[model samples]
Target: MLSRLRRFTLCSLALVPFAGPALAGDTSAWSAREGTAARLVAGGAQEGSHDGSLIGGVEIRLPEGLKTYWRYPGDSGVPPHFDWSGSRNVEAVEVLWPAPVRFDDGGSFSIGYKRDVVLPLRITPKDRSQPVDLKLNLDFAVCGKICQPANAALDLALPPGGIGAPSAALTQALASVPRPAELGARSEPGIAAAELHHASDGATIRIATHVGNAATADLFVEGPDEDWALPLPARETGADGRTIFVLPVDGIPKGADVTTARLRFTLVDGDRAIEVDTPLSAR
Candidate 1:
């Protein structure tokens, strides 16, 4: 039997320090942690350029068993939000999501990380050679069987030069971040349409998965941003075990058209990872 809502409880690890003081800055910037197995360790920082802008990321690690949500928290959570108001030189920060996996939490399925992961950010540096101090306020929700929301404030300082060299652990952790699956292995595009119902309260998206074998296919949604902290939506199968899923849009942008939103998701059943991308439109 497919699982239901009441069974899931999300556990999160925001900015928990597990090791020595990171070379760039100090931990005094962020708040406290709640999860013992899932703590944030300064994965390190980097300086580079994307397009023509100064770019880099504040790397963080979420180890095994403990999962973190994606920008589009499939069904019930909010994505991680970071406020970088602490640095004067910092112009902006954009998160880049590596791919994500579909997991059955409680009885509801969603997209996120199950083990070690890294989140890269594009930052405008004050001085490439001089040190830059950053203070960030982050928030997210995690689920296992009981859901709990976590909040933190973190401070990191980057020294002159660059983030230096990445440790072997960082390299391995990066490898675990989800990436886009091969297109050829995906199902046909017309198999589903996520209809959004916008109202004064919020948005509600109904995902209709059209497949020959509903029991063999599962669905997940990715967000337009990098912090995957959104909640896993509550889902229900119709009489045929294949039908529409009603998802709450509490954190989603109100009246925003998902029609143009660039999204990528996977349909995993057994060992097959069927990737799909939806163009902006309403059914």
Candidate 2:
């Protein structure tokens, strides 16, 4: 039987210390953290936009020796939680996560950020003509010697024409987002191949991508939804002369047919990362 998996939330009672715009001069910043700050930015809302979706984001500047977690916090960290209850005209919120580095958190292996980071949001509005009032109550954990829980309430009213001045922080953040992976496409920032093998326990996923430096590379995998917590990936050099990563799948419903399951992989190498969703197979 498949057990229900809820959002990975930890217990905490620390006073929210962040709640305004970040220090990088974004006016929509809402500072509400202890050692970090948070800001909300909206863009791509111009005349005759073809995508029909608005791009928004939250920028977090991590001071020296501070770090934050990704959507999946690896082994023993907290994943961020966003509450859009106060949002107006928002139909959906699709979060775009950057590649994370693997490190030890509280003596346990984990995956997260070692420096400043940005979380871009792809928002679908109910009415494109109307302005969007983006209200975000973001709860995330930042760590140094101790893990600290922080929260920030931010609101941005995105009107047409977007920000007059281009924000370097946001521009860089948008660039860092992973490009979609294409198997056998033989392109820069693309996936070479991915293979999955099923077992009695669950499954093992193997992926290979083109990378310049293997030592600085890392791969992170995510399950079908926010509730599934998967293990970290192991890196190795394939016999076929490609950078390979293997991940063991475990936390899923018992007897669930995962032969056709889909998984998302984020390959992070230095300042570049790409994302791809690969389907599982019985073979």
Q: For residues 159-180, write the lDDT of model 2, one tens digit per residue.
A: 5434453367666777887888
Reference-based TM-score of each model: 0.54, 0.83
Q: Runs in model 1 with CA error above 4 Å?
A: 1-65, 173-219, 222-283
lDDT of 1 by residue, 43-152 (tens): 33443554322324444444345566765555444456666786645656667555566677655556676655556555556555566565566665555554555555
Instruction: Write down the worst ten-residue block by lDDT for model 2.
Output: 1-10
Residue 274 local lDDT, model 2: 83
Q: What is the Cα root-mean-square deviation between model 1 and the actual structure?
A: 8.2
Question: Which ranges of candidate 2 are over 4 A from the true structure?
Answer: 1-13, 21-26, 32-34, 44-48, 198-203
Taken over the whole model, the C-alpha lDDT of each candidate is: 0.50, 0.71
